[model samples]
Target: MNVEKFKKDHNEILALVAELRTITQAGIAKNADAIAQQIRTMSSVIKLHLAAEDRVLYPALAKSQNPAVAKVGERFQQEMGGIAAAYMEFAGKWTIGSKVSSNPEGFKEEANNLFKALHERIQKENQELYPLADQI
Candidate 1:
């Protein structure tokens, strides 16, 4: 019934994304260290958020008597696995400041794509998933 924690995590994730966007707008070469550090920070938050969802949220929804809700949960869980994997790869690849510094353009392109994916996922979770959970 209480979905505040997940909502808060979503807010934090979005805020970190906004900060990353702002840092990269000035260009990654000059902000490599900051970018890498921000990524690391976001990684920590994301790891915790995902862990919480896995431990508490998904299982509950999957067991729900409401078939529609269970289906949505299963779909979200399956979809998130890919997004999470991509994010882990992206975070691992760019966590080093030197890596970001060496290939700012590549980092920018990859980051743009990854961030877009994250944004879409978060929006769906907030608009669709959480509301379903609230109903349950």
Candidate 2:
């Protein structure tokens, strides 16, 4: 069974999120070495995804010349700032081992919160942004 590339990529990204959540929940002493590395890798993948979405979709939608679409595009950009800030905070903090590994439970809670926010952002992009892009 050959999965579509985007679908495969999306699934892998979600899986990585879950894996990080699991690792953090397992206690950092046992997984300390791996946590930062995994988060770094995930951050890179996420940036790529976001950049691609920005390149192909956001600009396209914004420049659509349709009043409704342009409005949506503007709102989308504004809304994304919150999501982006949250992600950046998570990514930057987790890159420092001491911050993430210092208190495993605390780290897990923060990670889960960020992951939940990311999941909602992705769902919004897929549901509203992607379709808006397609509409144009």
State the RMSD for candidate 2.
3.6
Across 95-123, the per-residue lDDT of candidate 2 in tens digits comes to 86776667767777788788888788767
True lDDT of residue 54, candidate 1: 94
lDDT of every model, 2 decimals: 0.96, 0.74
Model 1 lDDT, residue 43, Cα: 99
lDDT of 1 by residue, 31-134 (tens): 99999999999999999999999998999899898999999999999999999999999999999999999999999999999999999999999999999988
RMSD (Cα, Å) for all candidates, in order, is 0.7, 3.6
Question: What does the lDDT read for residue 83 in candidate 2?
Answer: 81
Per-model TM-score versus the true fold: 0.98, 0.83
Best by lDDT: 1
